[model samples]
Target: MHNEGKTKMIPFGDLSREYDDLSIEIDNTVAGLLKSGWFVLGKKVEEFEEVFADFIGKEVFAVGVGSGTEALHLALVASGVTHGDYVITVPNTAVPTVSAISFSGATPLFVDIDPDTYNIDTNKLRELVVIEKKRRGNKLKALIPVHLYGQSADMEPVLAIAREFNLTVIEDACQAHGAEYKGKRVGSFGDYACFSFYPSKNLGAYGDGGMITTKTPEQAHTLKMLRNYGQEKRYYHTIKGFNSRLDELQAAILLTKIKYLDTWNTRRRDIADFYNQNIKNKAITKPVEVSYGKHVFHLYVIRHPERDRLQAYLQNNDVQTVIHYPLSIHLQEAYKDLGYSQGDFPVAEKVAEEILSLPIFPQLRDKEAETVAELINSFS
Candidate 1:
């Protein structure tokens, strides 16, 4: 599939191009922050928190933290997930989601994902909750419904089941910035919603950062203290906490980038639409966007039975691709003690082998997208 002339290489993600596109504003924002002198947990962080909270939903409070993992850890602690309790989440998600649950000293339990959306299967979640409640009793403390790949999980039933089982809901919305379910943003549906601002995320910062959104003022206050070494005052340490503050520099950068989130997300959606319509190979399964909400296309993933062969073919043709998660968390060696085996989560295990992420960033050009599609179609 090599071209007569060298084909241009398409990158899976190009943050450098995004920075180049917004270099002026980003430069000015970082410059202003450098001159301000106050860096950690300063006014810039406060401003970004408020702006992000407003973006998620009215009356929601956002707390800036060091990384998305910290956001989830703090949110779990604030919501009372503790040692010996079991927190449930999909096994197909990135390890950080499970790591956050483990960080709270709670054991992680597995659920399968929806074959279409790659989010938690709500029916399986309900069945697990019922069985776990009767067996583990109230020790089954929380549920982290991950909004994987920029689409919200079926939150109505997720929340309803949470209430029925008396389990706290913490949304793993690290990939779902600005994503919505039934007209409401993802962060609003959970007791606490965690987000990551890793450089590649939908709402990425220049470096590592994260946020937790909550509707409760008390929870917000607790999170603020938790992120800043448990300090309620200048020298007062009230509760056990961690050092995980989002610095002013990243906060300022995020503030600049936040202004363009919608536009950038729209461009991402447009690219996904192009891929969806053009990649007509019967062997490929285009991502499904459920009718219940908007998917912001954080990662334009597709599936094929011979996923590895397809990825290698695209690479050989000067196109880039990646597997979202080549290994499901339960199968990873880090969680071997969790007692999960190969067939424990059939859908997640099967999807793990087949999912492939194509080039998809707001900065990616239509020509590059078309080239990617052509390469995929040409793959035998």
Candidate 2:
């Protein structure tokens, strides 16, 4: 139990304790890697990819790359999204989501999100794809459905729509490491699934890392070639590519970390469950878990009309919180040329205003979570 009389500073996220918990094992694994004198796309990366592929199931091929952004870019290139083509994805995502589209030589087209789930609204997506295809004549080449906030998007209809429109589907499972839809893993649902292992992710590496999952052999081969200067064999360039290979160091750390992903995700759910059962203030809206999928609660976001005030209050109460996103990608200064205005995505824009990311890492104490809820309940 927390002593309400004694206040302490609670961080939005604290990775130090997580590291302390794994210090011995991580140190040992890292020491072994440093001694091996083999880094940069070596045996460790190959081993990690095989293990990860099995983890995702269905004989899926996993190719490790430099970062999640690179995973998206490589997947888009493998799926044939070239210059002048448009890639469809929701705008209420990390800027890297759109940046990856630009990197692949495709214009990013925005779609609004389902307010309840905070994932792309598949119905609106279908309508937009159909309308855009008619108006633009097949410039829409791919769909990147982000499994936002550790929840799987309702993928069935999205997949059906993709098939109907002959568009390649890329699952942006960057935040949803082990999330499931209809008892199937998220990365398995699309033609290419991209994952990020940044330090803050559910399955994070100490540094930037990513993986691309696909069922097709040719696509996997192409991704491998594309991530390593277009060379399948050393000094033998097959095509123009980028030097975006995942290094052996991150791979070794990830190999150690992946074993605990499920356990951590389960702990995250337990914390989310605690939050859901408590925190009944009418001023705030709690996140909803869709019936079709499991939400891993990457960020236990809640909404308050006075989100900024609530955050201020929490900060003064010795708790730190952040907005998962303060601004939607379309409205950001970088995408000004995309010609998007404030009213374009009403749900996303509203979410951007109200969302507050409470600290919910696996290492967070139950007492800490209770304190956070108690502060919110006590807020005027």
Candidate 3:
């Protein structure tokens, strides 16, 4: 759809546009917060937490944290996962997922992902749980099923497997804000669900922020204490905790943005639909939406054998793209101490090599999306 004489450079994400769209509301909210003179863990933070908890599900309680990693880490700690415990997760996710487990003083274990869904394969998870139980009985403390790319990781089987093995379930929903499974939202399934509001997330904040959703009031209280130097009241420490409280400014910004999350997500899906219908290249594989749930399409990723070549061609043609992950966590140098080999997670490694994330955001023009697809279609 771009002019032949002039190539248009489509960015992978444009946070500035998102800000511009919400500038008046955001500026007003920020100005009001500045006038209040209270910055950390104030009224705005409590309001956002309450609203977010209600959004996730009935009876869900949300605790705002400093970052998504801290959300996962605190959730694990609150669940009693500690040193010498092994936590299971897929290897194909962002490093923060693994980092959270490690920060809890628990060993991180891996299972391969389903090729189609790019989620933790339930079959592989079950088999690995059985094997782990036999080898290290009662040491497997938790299961962190990452809802990668805004689709729930088939929660039915995942929850069943956790119950069978007595493992606590933590949903890493950093990329899935309004995503649902079988009509129920993602954050409701696990014992605790973690979300990130980094600048580019589907429901992003102006800066780093995170949330943890839980069903138990006791756990919610514990999380509140843990995020603020273990204080049940002012300067009263009950247990050792960290300085991971969500600030008031970010919380105010999120409050303004939260009202528009569903709209933005719908626009993202529209862009994905346009890409799916228009990209006619047979060599490129489009993203598949599972039958059981709604995918917010946080990242509209595609696959091809000639991934590197295709990326270069797109780049040369002024169409920007990026790999969701170029390397699986198991293969990363920092995680080598986990004792995983090169071939440990074959599916994840293979998919990592082939996956490429195209631009999909609320503000992206339909013509821009069509242009991206056209560019990909023309790639040999």
Worst 10-residue lDDT window, candidate 1: 1-10
The C-alpha stretches of model 1 lying farther than 4 A from their native spots are 1-5
Q: How does each model score on lDDT? A: 0.92, 0.93, 0.93
Candidate 2, backbone clash total: 0
Candidate 2, residues 340-380, lDDT tens digits: the string is 99999999999999999999999999899999999999998
After superposing candidate 2, which stretches have Cα over 4 Å from the reference? 1-6
Per-residue lDDT of candidate 1, residues 236-332 (tens digit): 9999889999999999999889999999899999999999999989999999999999999989889999999898888888888888899999999
Top-down lDDT ranking:
3, 2, 1
lDDT of 1: 0.92
Instruction: List clashing residue pairs in candidate 2.
Output: none
